[model samples]
Structure formats: C-alpha cells, structure tokens
Target: MMHKPVVDENERRARQEAHLLVREFGAEAPLYAAMKAEKAIEQKDFGRCARWKRVLEILADEPPADLRRSAAAK
Candidate 1:
C-alpha cells in the first residue's frame, strides 16, 4: 500500500488562509504578499519574510482564473 505524506497542521492552515486571501482579494493577493516579504527583508525580519514567502509559494500553486473559468464553463 502506498502511503500519502502527512501534512503538518500549521502548513495546512497557512495554505487555507492563502487561498481565502486570494479569493477575497483576487489576482493581486500574491503581489501584496510578495511586497510584504520584500519589506520584511529590508527590515531584517527573516521570520516574517519566511512566512510571506511561503504564502507566495502557496499562491503560485493555485489555478489561474482563466483555467478555473474554462473548467466551469465546460
């Protein structure tokens, strides 16, 4: 039997939160998160930077709006 990798609870929560943010704010959500990450880098707040970077990573994996629309229209 093949076993699926276990997801950490915090990581799962972050992904869910990122998706909700993207849905609520639309395409610019990732852009905003990236800007924050850049600001964090300037401030030398590596932890905050890491969190925002992770959010961008999660956002990158989300389906594009066009793909979602096409699938829905099918």
Candidate 2:
C-alpha cells in the first residue's frame, strides 16, 4: 500500500477564490488603463500616459442612457 497526503479541497477553493479576486481587480480593463497611466508617469512617458489617462477618463465618464440601462439590467 502506498501512502499519499490528502489535500484539503476547501483550502484549494479558498486560494482559487482569492486569486480570482486579485485578477479581477488587477487586470480589470479600466484598472489596467489606470495602471498604465501610472506606469507611464513613472517612466516619464508623457505622451503614452496622456493617451491611456484619456482613455481612463473617457471610460470614467457617464455612459449613454441606453448603455447604462442595459448594464443595470443584470
């Protein structure tokens, strides 16, 4: 008979959940845009950051009524 270590499924699930949360926040489209802007600032990439920041700003603006309505449907 071979002995094997048992893994706790609950712990694995918890780690997966935590990883998902981090990814959701980290790679979020809008958040990525914001982070890009910040990175550009650090690198003195004014033009690049300006473009990304503009994108972030535009995304932050109010969406059209229809879009907002549709997004709220869920």
Best candidate per lDDT, number? 1
Worst 10 residues of 1 by lDDT: 63-72
* Candidate 1 per-residue C-alpha lDDT over 1-74 given as tens digits, one digit per residue, 9 for 90 to 100: 99998988757655655666666667877888888789999999997787788878877876547324443454
TM-score of 1: 0.62
lDDT of 1 at 56: 84
The lDDT per prediction is 0.72, 0.53
- Best candidate (score: TM-score): 1
Error of 1 at 47 (Å): 0.8
Error of 1 at 40 (Å): 0.9
C-alpha TM-scores of all predictions: 0.62, 0.44
